[model samples]
Target: MGLVTIEKAHVASELLVLKSKLESEGVICYLRNEYTTQIMNYLPSFEVELQVSELDLEKVREIMTRKDAE
Candidate 1:
C-alpha cells in the first residue's frame, strides 16, 4: 500500500520524536517536508508530516492517541 500522512506538526524536533516512537513500536514511518519545514519555519504550508504505510494507519492512530493521553 502507499504511504499516508497521519500527523502534522509545526516543529521538526517534535515530529522527529514522534517518528522515533512509531519506529520503536515497529511501525515504519517517514517524515515529509521535515527539512523544508525547518528551513521555512515561518511558513505554515511547510509543516512537518508523519507518514506511514496505508496498512498501518489504524495502528499509528492508536499509538498517537495513547501518546496524546500522556
Candidate 2:
C-alpha cells in the first residue's frame, strides 16, 4: 500500500506521542526520518513525519482535526 504523511513534529517525543495515538486508533502508522531527525536535531528543516496508508489519509486527518478542536 502507498503511504501518505498525515502529520509532522519537530520534536521526537511529540512524534512518538502522535504515532502512539494513531496506532491506538487502529491505524497502521509509520515514522519517517525519525532517526535522522534525532541525529540531526540542529537542522530545523528535518522534522519527523508520521505516515499511514493512503486509504486512511482522510480518517487520520479527521481524527487529528477533532483532536485539535478538543
Residue 36 alpha-carbon offset, candidate 1, angstroms: 1.0
Off by more than 4 A, model 1: none
TM-score for all models, in order of appearance: 0.79, 0.80
Model 2 misplaced regions, further than 4 Å = none
Predict model 2's lDDT versus the native.
0.85
TM-score of 2: 0.80
Q: Residue by residue across 1-70, what tens digits does model 2's lDDT show? A: 6999877888767877778878888989988998998899999999888889998888888888878898
| Residue pairs that clash (backbone atoms under 3 angstroms), model 1 | none
Root-mean-square deviation of candidate 2: 1.6
| Alpha-carbon lDDT of model 1 | 0.88
